[model samples]
Target: MTKSHDVSVQDFNDEDSNVSSNPTFESVLNARLSRRNILRGSIGSMATAVLGTSVLSACGGGNDEPAPGPVPQFTPIEKLSFAAVAKSLEDKVTVPVGYTASVIYALGDPLRAATADYKNDGTDADFENRAGDHHDGMEWFGLGADGKASLTSVDRGLLAMNHEATTDEKLSSFFLHADGGKSTLPRPAAEVDKEVNIHGISVVEVKKAADGKWSYTKDSAFNFRLTPWSDVELSGPLRGHALAKTKYSPTAVKTRGTINNCGTGKSPWGSFLTGEENWVGYFARGAADDAARGDKSVVALKRYSSVQGGASRHGWETAGTEDKYQRFNNSKTGASADGSDDYRNELNTFGYIVEIDAYDKTKAAKKRSALGRFAHESAVFGKAEAGKPLAVYMGDDSRGEYIYKFVSEAVWDAADASPASRIAAGDKYLDKGKLYVAKFNADGKGQWIELAMSNTAIAAYAAYKFADQADICVNTRLAADAVGATKMDRPEWCSVNPKNGEVYYALTNNSARRVDATGSQVTVDSANPRAYSDVHKAKSSPQLGNSHGHILRLKEDAAGAAATGFSWDVYLFGAEADASTSNINLSNLTGDQDFSSPDGLAFSPSTGICWIQTDDGAYTDVTNCMMLAGLPGAVGDGAKKTLSYTKADGSKLDVDTYVGKAPAADTLKRFLVGSIACEITGLAETPDGKALFVNIQHPGETTAMANIANPSKYTSQWPSNAGYGAGKRPRSATIVITKNDGGRIGS
Candidate 1:
């Protein structure tokens, strides 16, 4: 949806609406940049309704003075051109006229010569040697002759991608429980094992021949898989913490593996950072589990939705009473003290950023807990200047969540970018850092409030008692609450503009922004100021929420990643192209450039081009999920636009805020569309910008369990019928796109 999609004024009659004119815009903007105002504005109603005091300490002051820094040399694209692909709901991949896309590898494909070919059927048994399902964030690293990461050699590279999760059981009929339902008793162990082994990350070698043709080397020694069954170590702040202790690792220094690995990043020292998201749902707590823990423990779990008595998503624990399957149970069941005899502490070990050495298969991946755990969308590092500490930006992917950043304590050395050991580099930096939450003020400025028990305010917070550094780090959300961090509308993947170091985030749609009758509302605020009816196909009830989410950009003070203060604005607003509204679709999108629920986002380092991908439920009836290429300008590129629409009472209300310059075909254009019932996510480009890799996830995911026996009932038969394979079932896969003339993409 674009700014002009709807003609009606926004309806803000909800109880939490702060649309009053009492404190005018100017008053709010010019007010002293104090911790109190920072807390109020950033947390919106959550802070006022909860925390009575806001000033954490004056340590991290609100210095509004702007800092200056060096400007980046962005590659110009004024003469670049490419035919925009038309939107489609077809069960196949579509690309621009001059660009061609081919499947590189897919779910269940064999990654080793010893394994048999994938049948695309439910009976394949070599999951340990096969590609995992639901391909997500990925990266390309140049490969050396010794099968290690090389700074150069773009033609031959190692591709590391995350296998986030599997599709609905009915869609693939692969490894899902029989009857497509959770079992109350022992489940089929073989199926459970396969499902567990198909998650985590996949590192495979790919090479582009002289003719520009790309192919994955099936027998490459560099090919490896890190699944839920793999052994991994714990590192950083929480490495030796008591909370990380489990039966499998009484030393509290190791864990089994990573799960639900989503968005990822390629580190400067040549390692992979895989984010763990939606991991709590995979663990189950017994019915009487709450009796075994303290109130603070329960509160922390509930904050992350890992409460006691919760049933696991797939009932993995029901597979058997053995430790292997029972580890999914977070309930207190052991006779031993500290809950180490059971898996109560298991959930805490899974939600951190896992660091992997894709170039060294012999090394074990480490879960870095010092980064602060939450539903991590992804972690993108900022420019590392010599003698300055490095900064890592991240977002929590949930409605009404907060944004965070971690600043390394050690100063950066350019030589470390090509270090002798990436793991050692990680230990020197990621092991010691300060985690901070964002506080976006009304004057287009933001503050990075530190989340530390050292702050008296955090220690005194009544919501959850803080014990020590580990407590604050383990329960990061509570620390954020005490500091009054800004609650966003489901902050997702973030990208740092390579040209200027500005950070951009995709706040996917939120259907619960207004004060609801049930009292579960996220009040509209300056950053998220819209609440209206976006009613799509289902008209039984008005979709009174932020249906078409927006992209927010921030410029660090002085253009430094570690700057505590910054400027910000909404870069673009999503809405329907032909809607009868004005300014609602701030980008002024037409059918050719329209999209919703912008999820996956990436800025090409070489071309300075921003790629936007969608995971939409609002526009699926009209078009399937898609990806678009955009050339974005710096922050504050447009003016404040106030939009109005008539409400049901015939009264008109206005939404006043900054909006980006209207996008045109040349600036923002559709690039590709995925199969039906699919989400287009996880994009990466070769450093030279010659080839682009896009992930198509969960095609035909909406198929009902009752339709499992009928392949004809599936909504999509994607890469299989798209010239990559010949199976009736749809599988998630990675597609490599390139220009026919062997030139830079989007050129």
Candidate 2:
């Protein structure tokens, strides 16, 4: 029911943006699973231990057969002690029995003291001074009582999070409008203005009270929101380049606002890095404009458009005649043949790693253009030492997209971690970097393809002629294509193992995969080797591609993150415990650990636990979206395994890919489950690792607009039903969880 143009990028995708001729990471497309019943069993008794010869025989052990022992877990991981949280379909958050989840911040919460309390009804306004909606990726920045940056201040700290779009259906954000808003075009200016306020990023100070209860400080000096109207400078390679200029910033030094902020990260120098995901859907492309632009521009534009149409995601452009709102319209396609006077270039300003100084709101946010951009999921810098070069890894959050790594031109200086100006430190390390995209080989090895103008392939490309390095940075997707990067399956959040320096990435499920020759359907390949059907078991939510995604990890050949050669493997394959085949359930997941669409991933800096969050549909019938805590293993713990499948014409195909050591209950277990229609997104933790912060996004998101009046019919009435917020209408919230006895989480 979701047309690509009618909803956000997460719901549907009608555009095949991957135009590369490289091998598509193919899998059989989709379905989801969920159930409320509990399946209690031991680690060995659970059906997850049945790893046939096709999966585990690759390690080349001394023995001829597998070890005669209980289901083996990753030996390097610490033994988990908490009982796995049972899957639940109830309209509330569920955690381990000993943990308490308290609502710390929620949608419409007052960020400033003067802002009135949120009525929880749709009439609320002034979101600029209040907490924005759909809280996604978040990071913890500790601050002292006096508001200076702190490394050990648990009582006072800043929670910098992204307000990733809104909970909307079709074109209208009904949840924010009193009369369920307008579902048609020429949307009311007032409605558009509210939406414009609810997006971008927010930095609020959260504190633990004397009574041990956690809450946000209403008037903290650290609190601020970067809305669509805020000023943001374009830095690095595109600082004053012509390709980055628009009518609003003709000189191209700056632009207005950031949107569609998704996953987030903490820079080495104590700054916040946020990825601009799926920002193209927000711009309106006029019909006539496609023909007016240069041929190369059209090629790049179409590849960037996930859902191409004249209609904007929200009708912000039609709301007014002012340039502020009209800027949302790429009508340059209709006016200037070359877009010299239009806002076409405005689109180029976005999709970069925007760095915000966590400690200083006075510093304007900068778009780090040196990091090649596409649908940036998030950018995580690897372990930084005193004199080594720093490498930041990113994933393009789209089907058949590429994973990227940017190595800084300057060597790391430990003193920069606490430099006088964190933003200046960002300028030193992030502004000049060598951007490279991953190319995974079938032989279980990968190379980083440099995305520079000096590269022969990019310099001599015929598809989209590269004018210079500045143009290449702006059109990063096309540049990645020209260099033939390995197309992955919706690569999402990335995390680095503090214990081993290995990097892990989430390849959230893809829906465009196929096993045979189908129009626009991807074929099965090594890195993305599964293309099975989920319809047989998950009857309610039939889908295409890898519905239950898997985790892929890489280890540098050398000890440093700057190494260009790496060894990689599929770490854990998400699946139902009852999965009939061993190929799909290679991780040996049980009911307590199985999940679909691994989207949000982070490793606790103090605990070394990989927290896996899900944004799923296929498995909703069985349980709500959830989070899993896992202990990671180093790369090469397991060896190559070949999976065989029969195509529609009865021809056999074999896919050889690297698999990691299978996870048992002791290594990976479900930790928390969210409410109805809610996605378990952003996560953060105290330095002590005793307090965990999680973002519950878009609860009751499927509530039909027709039933907006009837709270009983809404898919969910969360935080409200949990007695935390004011109204019965559900609100996205950040919940703080801690052990009842005050112990570390996921221990």
Candidate 3:
């Protein structure tokens, strides 16, 4: 059954109407032209007036609501041309006036005693302890006053970054064959071990200069890298599960390093939390393995989709028979029912948020199993209030998944940052919190249904048998499904408003959504808000799935993440505003806010500005994926607006609730655009807001090996473009942005 609601006028009221008092576009342009006294500027001055009039009229009305004031404009401090360097052969990293960046670390960078010096040319023989490939999300933690683990020390800090996954030939030096395809066979035992070690998190200490420049301190005592091979312990709910047991560790209390570490979070007590994403694809399980074990439940089979003898994408099983290498295979070969030696349960070990105390490397990191397992993208925490339950919001980055939140069992204490604190903080707070999955009802309101094992629906699920609360926690997806939680478009990254406690999630995309299929396909729901197939923009890269994603906002009751009920609405939809007015383009976006496949998300605590970064392959025609900054109004600001879309078949598809108007440049603006073939991910801000750190991942990504030698043949050459010739291989780097006059960013 389809449900629809009427738009409300109260939803369009701008919360910042009182403080947003910038000049109109025409006035600003006239002021600049008058100061410059340029003939060309005067000739185009009239065009600006016409556009400004339209924008002013749209934002102004006779209704009781206050009009949105003139849009704020920023004058560039400086536009530093691309630096000319040999490292950046293919791509470019554009910096505004007074800002600069460098490659602090990369794929083959050495991390331990095994590899001392790194050969940036990709000829390193040992990578087991080296930095992993495809660096994604990261965090920066300041050292303490005693030169220990302080959260307030600005001069010295630790940077923990995740290596999401490796691109085929880039998996290792030997994995790439001469034919340009991966060697179907697995590597030797040593090679297998190396791959495991490279697939986790890289933790290093960085020191900042008096002038605000940051660099890695290789000799820092606290600097260390955690990989899949590192021995780690399982904490929280599933610590002693039979599935977690292995010959290497019979207790099941301890496991190994995390894999597919993606979006990250930081603890109030000064620690790092890295999330495991798409971890299920790493194991290979034969379909017959489950049946032979006499465990053929539909739920088990569906959860662990093992159709063939094994599904090892990296061919790690071909390495050796040692449990270390063979554990990647989930096929059952033993006759015993215990299955203690088998890898079938290895898949369960991943998909949890692994917590690492960067200050004390000797401490063992714990996987907070309380947070349900599904392609976890990130964990964002709400502001920590002393003596209040600590709230954390997370996302499962899969099509048609649900968002999750966890409230600590114990109230937060500001004094807990001391060294004497035990795992007690994690044990008392994170381990026993109530895990709630979201359900957006039809009335624009949502409920946080508890997925605890005590819940009857979760306890009686027919799929995988839930023996107890621990089982339900380990199999959180099953628990969430049993309670009929509302499914959403791939919930990727989440950011909470420190100012008002509002939660925002990136609904990346969903291809399974259809307009007709009533049961399986996603229908038009209030939170989802749209159902239409996306059209491909590039002929070579056909956009098959829901590529252009959108953003969702949830306003908790009483302005707190601990609130059980919340109001939700579609904040933005990715579309080429100039495209067809039908299904493909629902949001009437202009060039300013129009973007596709929103991924990484972060909010500036100082400015209360939400920065939305994109990881898109859908709309590459107009420009590469870009980042947009917006001053979001509260959740109900546009709750009553409706949008009408004309479909490809010439029929109309109507949508309700606040998504039709163009944001004034002051409300939302394009802060920056990235270079070609790069995803603008990972953001960190200094405490004083004096410097901003941003990561440029996988530049020159589309370049071929044959073009490696020629700078002109590559797609980008960024930092080195300053004065050198083009065509240097692009090196992924962390950029430091600061105002020339040392003012706060976006201030």
Candidate 4:
């Protein structure tokens, strides 16, 4: 396939300038291709073919490329003690020297007077209205001295935790039945409504004492829960598109609650943006339904991955065939072509960043369409520059996906903070913006190719015809592909340095990558630098797959949002040093920092500190997943090294690499390790950095439901019985960590 051609350079001032002047594919073919002139080059089949050939050939001939240097090692620091002590016997949060932690809130924790106290034995009938399961990402917002929420206050605050998904089988005892599925049982609408109300987000007011310990107020007025069934509105380009229309809200401009809120983002105006990922898979559709709706195209089928052959995973489909359950189906079942008979447009309602006004509970949530539709991991904004458009970067989370960035149309305004101001800021800045996908070049330099509708190559794509700006925004991935964006290895959560504005992406593990082309192997590229197989037995079962993951970093051009060029490098490579010489442990990682699947990432603005957390099944043997604190220097702070590996065919492949390094003890230290059978995810800090909040998700996950009630049979009883039977079922929770001396974290 040839590389997508770049459009001609023109004056960037035309608001109505079509990135492509022609609307029809035939019109694009008839357009002139002026190679002699730098500004008007047209992209055709030849350009795409050449680009594909170059990419494949570049990976095939490994000898021509320079080899990366040897992995650098770091000193190991003393491991923190793993103590199982707290007010509750089930608590299992860990802390480094001079620090302590406490469980502030947990699954099913009550947030309002309407909800009853949590019955720790899983017998709570009111749990449907309580908090959901598996807390992931979170944020801290301060309440002002005047009793209103303030974005800048440093003391009293509200903690907004995302209740990602649920583990409960029934909404209440009344819904329980002999069969494992919900189809065998029936429940009241009130019960179903409660389940819906508990599945979104939990906002609880928390305050820090003079001693630096954080705790929730018993009757905090700001405490509230935002669930999936709540009413929400749309913002940005495709807000009122025909594809977004639904029965509940015919305008398609309004919908209900957020789902699969994995990672979190905060707007400059002080609101939280929760990303809805893996949402399409939640809906159920009939296999033969798409053909009836005129949306049976292969693209549409693959995009929605309609579950026509099976029922919904969470059993929400059996909640009654009312528009509620029917809305979950992406297949066409109705008689009309007006989207009145079926809920095929439901899939389009999600996948965008759902913005929430944390302070103003009355404001409706808005899904910002300008951010693009994909499996968004998180939306992180760079430090705002006066007169410069705001920069927001996101990762597509799926294997072999691309990272994207959106630059706002409006300049930064420091005075925007209230709910009204926040909405105004989003409308002026996020609604109309330029989106660009990343392309990592061979020479450690990368470029941001604009995926504008005006681009001629996008206008001519045969896969799906692009009509206007709405088409470009809704079908963003296709447009990015048309512009030649580099496919990466599971690009997950992204973090930008507050001081330097450099971007970092967590490229989680890809097991399909191959050392050499075999029928089952995935060919390695520059972006996905590692290819290896592992033989290990997980708690679930024995398996062979790529267990270790890596991190990639890029520096923006001249510290500006408009910069097209950037320098790139591999910040860290995930591996076990004892495994093989070819597996480079660049951080000179000991068993402590040798983590698999680096997921959640955050940087402290006060000290420029970087905290890395893990969500893995690979390195669980060494210990439960852990968290590490690092002081990152820059994109290219380490030396250019070379790496050597042997293919399955007994041939050697070598390539040049860049890996970061620092004193093992001081720079790359394993600050804490979690309890048994848990993944350490999510991180947040107080404004002064005096305290830190960490989440421990699904402890004792390996335990079977049959043995859940027996403490001796379970691998862990964290946050309940640190030693023996604590009666309470294991639940995920947010732990508050603070230093005894009241000093800033990582200081």
User: What are the Cα lDDT values of the candidates?
Assistant: 0.72, 0.79, 0.61, 0.62
Identify the leading candidate in terms of lDDT: 2
lDDT of 1 at 409: 91
Better candidate number, 1 or 3, judged by lDDT = 1
Model 4 lDDT tens row, 584-670: 355566544456778888776555667777776666655567777766768878766655566555556664556665335456656
Expressed as tens digits, the lDDT of each residue in 177-294 for candidate 2 is 8878997888889999899899999998877765666778777777899988899999988989878768788788999999888899998788999998878878887777665564
Q: Tens-digit lDDT track for model 3 on 197-228?
A: 66788776666555455556555566677877
Cα misplacement distance, residue 635 of candidate 3 (Å): 0.8
Quote model 2's TM-score: 0.91
lDDT of model number 3: 0.61
Measured by TM-score, the strongest candidate is: 2
In angstroms, how far off is 720's CA in candidate 2?
Answer: 0.6
Q: What is the TM-score of each candidate against the true structure?
A: 0.88, 0.91, 0.81, 0.83
**Count of backbone clashes for each model?**
19, 18, 27, 36
